[model samples]
Target: MSDHVMACIDGSGHAMAVCDYAAWISQRLDAPLTFLHVLDNHPPPDEGNLSGNIGLGSREHLLEELAMLDERRAKLAQEQGRVMLEAARERAIGDGIAEPHVRQRNGELVETLSELESETRLLVLGKRGESAHLASEHLGSNLERVARALHRPILMVPETFSAPERVAIAFDGSKTMRKAIETLAASPLFERIACHVVMVGADVADLRSQSDWAVDTLNNAGFEAHGAVRNGDVETTLHDYCREHAIDLLVMGAYGHSRIRRLLVGSTTTAMLRSADIPLLLLR
Candidate 1:
């Protein structure tokens, strides 16, 4: 992997917010930032199917015109993608990224990201893209697929941007959660930020012990950490805690232990991704 941060943005209301979050991560990691806008290459259906009841002669003429229209639309899409990329690049530069790289590629977003994974260690994008903006229940089409296809860390930025001051780790006593804790503790990403370790479950005593252990693990690594044990299931508990406490960032393992294999096969990660209003830093 190239170790650069890849920020994917379509021309949705979330595009600028994605840029802001990407710029924040790039500056914090001191890594190069690359802005990508994928020109959707999925072709439209044939004119025959589209032109329902037109006569044969008119249909042939319409088919030729439709072909020309397809070409024209493709050209326009490419041009529009370039403009979006240029605007993102300029915004990143203004946000202190010295040389934000910009590229307009043609492909499905997930397929492109999988192909580019070798050079990318971190991927950033808006939680909801252009297509799903109208439906509150629908997730960004590319989010889940990209998360499933690649093992790299993904930062899903919401529609608005905010500088994170308090970061929380949704800790569970699992190997994956342990790895996420160690990684977050060692990285500069959470340095100087208040780290809150929250665990969701009814086993009060066990949960406290686990939270303490995780918090101590982080504190020993030089982070100012606090621990809390919440009562409820993972999704509702963690979400409510973050909201009530004004948490700016939520970090967690993409998948937990086999029983709770969120990203690998479970729906918890997807559920959280759909509802999480703040930025999420997901590790696999």
Candidate 2:
């Protein structure tokens, strides 16, 4: 993996938070920082408006005008993307990153990330972006797609920045949770942060054993780790645990027990992302 931390910014309310989070990670891991702003190639699906039936000559003229308009819009979009990227870099520098790299690409978010995914150590992004923020029914489309496409760890920040003191992980004794445990243990991101491992399931189930194993593994890996068992649904229990314990950051595996990309985010994960106010470090 590359030593650079990649932070995606779209000048939305969450962009600043992304920069701050990326700076924190860069400082903690002693890595360089790169800011990326992607300008999608196609127009918004809602923007295609057609005029009433017109003569062939009129239609040709209208099409030409539309092409020109599209060209101008593309130019403006590229310029705006550059400005946004520059501002993001400045913010990252202001947060103590000495010199952050800025890049503007023209493509879908996942496409850009696919090209550069292997070139970054960590990916930092906002929970929502410009167009998708108002839609409460669905999470950020690009965010969901990127999470499904990459195996790298993604740090999803909220609109506001708060330095995390403690991190809680939701463990379900599946391979997904194990991947999170193993990856987090070897990373420096949570070095000084307290680790809280909790499992939510029947009291008599094997959850306790898995929770115990997770705690021991984390402890052995040098984390200030402790495990607890909560009796309730996974999402509700995690939300309450984080709130009551004042966990600053929440970590968990995405789409637990399913490696299929189509399963993207299970109900529990979706609910947690939508309701939890803390930063979520989602592992693939």
lDDT of each: 0.83, 0.82
TM-score of 1: 0.91
Worst-scoring 10-residue span by lDDT in model 2: 46-55
lDDT per residue (tens digit) for residues 1-284 in model 2 = 57778999886888889989999999988899999988887657564323333346676778777777667777887899888888888888788888899988888889889899879788998888888856544478787678768777788888899999999998877777897798788888889789999888787658788898899888998999989998987778898999889999999876544456335446667777777678998887
**Across residues 1-284, which tens digit of lDDT does each residue of candidate 1 receive?**
48899999787888999999999999888889999988877743542234444556676778777677767778888888888999999999899999999888888788898889988969998888886656765787678787777889999888899999999888878777888888888888878999999888776787788888899999999999998887777888888889888999998777544663654425778888888889988888
Q: Which stretches of candidate 1 lie above 4 Å from their native place?
A: 43-60, 256-265
Pairs that clash in candidate 1: 1-118, 2-119
lDDT of 2 at 77: 79
State which candidate has the highest TM-score.
1
Every model's TM-score: 0.91, 0.89
Instruction: Pick the lDDT winner.
Output: 1
